[model samples]
Target: MIMPNEQKAPLVHLANAIGTMSEVSSRVGQYVLANPEKVVHQTVAELAEYTHSGQASVLRLCRQLGFKGFSEFKLALMAELAASERSTATDSDNEADRYGALLKRLTQSMQKTAYALHAEQLLAIAVHMVKARRISVFGSGISGLVSQLVSYRLMRLGLPAQAFQDPVLAHEVMTDVDKHCVALGISESGVTLDTVEFLKRARTAGAKTIAITGRVNSPVAQAADLVLLAVPIEPLTIGGDISPAISKIYLVELLAMAIADLSHAGRQRNERSKTP
Candidate 1:
């Protein structure tokens, strides 16, 4: 059955992953990029035939791009196509059209990231924060801003939190982290060496580690006891390199809200205990 145009696919995501995939998967990705409409309508076998690749390779490509299979990939393409068609259905260069396209892209970043993250993991992180002696946030570059913002939010909630942007100070502070603390690392790429090192040191010191990153399999994610996936905004999007920050902010805000709820619950318990 044909899916609705409102459904969104991650075409740009596939394109980006292709750059890191093996030759066979890259071939499949390139084929889809070159003929999205045709590939979407065709079966996986047909796509494999057209790309001169095996059906397994096509499936592998879909999974690599975070799809369940070719069917899911096609559905996403259909959604992208639908969005594209709507944007172009009108032929005028009006301000509305320009702004509409911009809004769509920005919302897409949040939707995609939200879909990628699991609620259970987020709740677990909140619980960890509720139980921790302190929460230390670490990031660099644009992620540094995210780290600081999250730290401030935690503090506003009456939690002991700090943001570390400098590698030297991060190392120095991490040296004092103990098992009672929580170490949270934010990295869009998940491979930032300094951030990963901080996480490692924190873990060695027995602190509970959490990683917020776009890459599920990244080193930072691998090192953390808990992983919170955030949708990465493409640099080529409407806002350039700052685009991905939207998704990061979205995930952090959710984390903050969750932590707040946990804190509220704790306060309620304390009040009830006092009454008894």
Candidate 2:
């Protein structure tokens, strides 16, 4: 029952969640990761036995990775294996192989992040933008670029939006953000102290807060009223320490598009009302 879903990567996603998975689940994940080629051709019961865990544990692991069940997980695994095998056929030059691997990593991370985000949440964030008096976007380092990117998109829609890269200045502005403002914090780690502080202070001032971060349980998410999860995959870059999650850009683009549609609809309605 291999489904060979080209749009999703089960192995990539499972690896990402392995860090925070339970002991039993981690064991199951490690087994599949270590022997993906073997596991792809095995039955559910066999995999469970191989991992020294039960069938339920195997099934549970599948669900946690956002698959319907074992069959779906197997399908995705088979597809990933097939794709990897195709890539391997072109390993003539070592440098090409390395470049291909990094390219695949970046693509897979973006795909997983796009797959993980929910449309309802994106729409909800858009709804907030449509109703807010002003928008404040916060991020540091690479996330700062994402913040500014999204802020510009919002401005293009004629929404009152501003990007705040400086935490000190952001903090000063947060004081003026009443319940009418929507404060968005973009962080790859979600634990950036300055960004988290901005969200906390924004909430304290009765502003609507939203966090777009890779960590679901991070301080920024905990402080904000809404959380949008993205992949923390970063490029091997020369910038400072690590670059911001590339997934952040994808999510913000999705947000901007959603907000645009909502903003357009709202404007049309307003014009219609005035015409009467």
Candidate 3:
């Protein structure tokens, strides 16, 4: 924990910033915010595992909030709890506050993603997605996890979508790419070598390529026929830190919604023609 703060600063900073932390960091932050007293009694591993985040996330959260490490964070927390009055806030109340903060953060991120990526652009790409014979999404690490989510969302919309975490497997699949196919890649930095290469090859194979990334100048974007700006976000969930991935997830949901709308409108047009 590198960001330095005073004794009473622990809870204060955490309550304010939990809304913006990475998923891992946010999990830890929310828990601590809800139960600073419980955390002061637990070890680093205990809290990390309990929150389903790693010890590193706990330590990172501590450092970012101005503690040297979990030890110092605990000390500060203890001091804050000691200085604070005994609260009547129920367990349910704390849970609600923690969840409310997280929801607010997610809502803000979704709003940012929408404003950053134009509706016209999203609809244009969505048109191709709806008409594509098939769709392949590539990603690695946490990005790979996001790819699975994207695939699942599109699949739920009745689109043929698949996610590839392994570059080699993605390569084999790319061999099947054709003009009717759509290839999408997710990489926050837009420079992830494997994801960029996959999109490049898919484009070479004649598929419409899309990239969700943070930079327009990135190799992945350069290889893509269309680029969906993955809003630069921080403070966890759907981020590569869980926050980075959150932006990507938000984009995918928007794309899915667009596809659903387009499909509905198209069906309505067909119905009207038949009725006449």
Candidate 4:
């Protein structure tokens, strides 16, 4: 049975971890919500004292959020603030300025994401994909696109790969998946009913399953054999809806490249064995 706190634990742990060292770190989130304008300019000590916490706690909070230190966290917080400002700006801004602002926001998000990706976790995923006899990927909507990209990269490396965007097809495939097969599911929200059901079915059928999603505490993550989490942040808005998709694609591309490199090495090893 799933525990009630299971869904909330990651965020709660994040808060508690920082709070343990400094009371200010726990309060920073509340402070930012109440005083959005000050978020961009508040120093660590100021934020700590304001929350009746210590500077050490503030730094610990930043680390828990996957930043190198307080300065990096401050930059990310400031970037989010700037994006929020651009979204709410009333004055007419030029098209070029808007585009530039959006670009900056996306770049910042991508940088943070790159920093959070664990090399060991990536290598483990690649190894699993390389060893599996067949691979199936599933997702819906935007995440379906990511699934397709994963399938495409695996196929290019000469592996048997397939992606199902349709729920019916995904369910059909899951029924026959075996121990030699692997299933990869991508979902940012981690609560997509269709995707979760398909993954559950795949696992029941004895296939190894992996999940790539934003929330570590999500049910989808709990159901998979392996879970890779993308740290969550506020949705980025540019002049339109394009930037968020582009930013997500950048991270997906990195995942694909890592798998491809590992698959290629596996193929080389197989060729040498056949020759001997």
Best by TM-score: 1
Pitting candidate 2 against candidate 4, the one with the higher lDDT is: 2
69, model 1: CA deviation in Å? 6.0
TM-scores across all candidates? 0.69, 0.68, 0.61, 0.64
Q: Across residues 67-149, which tens digit of lDDT does each residue of candidate 4 receive?
A: 66666665665655665665635222777776666565566555544544556667777777777888999988777887887
Q: Clashing residue pairs in candidate 1, if any?
A: 9-76, 233-244
Each prediction's total of clashing residue pairs, residues at least 3 apart in sequence or on different chains, is: 2, 1, 20, 1
TM-score of 4: 0.64
Candidates arranged by lDDT, highest first: 2, 1, 3, 4
Comparing 1 with 3 on TM-score, the higher-scoring candidate is 1
Per-residue C-alpha lDDT of model 3 across residues 95-211, encoded as one tens digit per residue: 776666555555655554554455677998999999999999999987889999999999999999999998999999999889999999988767899998898899999999999
Candidate 1 versus the native: TM-score? 0.69
Which runs in model 1 stand beyond 4 Å of their true positions?
1-96, 234-240
What residue pairs clash in candidate 4, if any at all?
22-57
Better of 1 and 4 by lDDT: 1
RMSD to true structure for each model, in Å: 8.2, 8.1, 12.6, 10.4
